[model samples]
Target: MDFRGQISAEFLLIVSFIVVIVLVFSSIAGPQSQENSIATAAREGATGAISEMSYTNVSMKPMRVTGIKITGGSNRVISISFERPVPPEYRALVINRTVESLLTVSGVKPVNSTTVRLGDRTYTVQI
Candidate 1:
């Protein structure tokens, strides 16, 4: 009996099953990986901003931070909420630098300083 066609059918079935399994796993993991990258970038940016503050201002910033990604609006922006609000020395500059660094690490090319609107209020940020 010739079995070539039967074997080819079985092989294709197995391959299709494997591809579907891989796709399902990747879909589950993709968003999680992006979130991790965002968190790392936020930490690095905040740390770099704080380090530079050392030269010009002698104050401390909160070590614990919660960075939330904000989307689904007319504009997309990142929301960085510290355990406490930012300290009051050259505050805007620090924020701008942190924003810039955050975008840079997350695979975005350098962007010029621009204004970001959160609700009715708009603030300048450097990306």
Candidate 2:
């Protein structure tokens, strides 16, 4: 019985197994990382928007950002909503200048309309 060919075959089998394991783990981790990144972008964008608004008017109550939704493919649509109603005119200005400026990542685009309600405002940002 010749042992040389057996050793080479066993080595190849082990290498293939390791490659498969790596691929499996990477596939599992990929979506999770993308989700985390999206969440981070939302939080950062909200924070910057709030800060910008606050800086302009010391008397104005701090605004609460309620949610952020990411849609579309390479040219992404980022929808950010605030709990408090922003004036119709200010909505476009704030999102375009303040919010969009902060979320300057290549493909992300923030929608100009803000969803609002007259109730207790929640600052919680959801991705």
lDDT tens digits by residue: candidate 2, 1-127? 7687998999999999999999999999975565456555565666576667778878767777777676554344556777786656455555544344434533443343332111222112222
Superposed by TM-score, candidate 1 places the C-alpha of residue 3 at a distance from the truth, in angstroms, of: 3.3
Writing each residue's lDDT as its tens digit, candidate 1 over 1-127 gives: 9887998999999999999999999999975575565456656766666667665565654344555454434444556665566667545765676666556543444444544332332333422
C-alpha TM-score for every candidate:
0.62, 0.58
Candidate 1 TM-score, true structure as reference: 0.62
- Each model's lDDT comes to 0.58, 0.56
Model 1, residue 114: C-alpha shift (Å): 5.3
Clashing pairs in 2: none
Query: C-alpha displacement of 10 in model 1, angstroms?
Result: 1.0
Each model's total of backbone clashes: 0, 0
CA deviation > 4 Å runs, candidate 2: 24-35, 72-75, 97-127
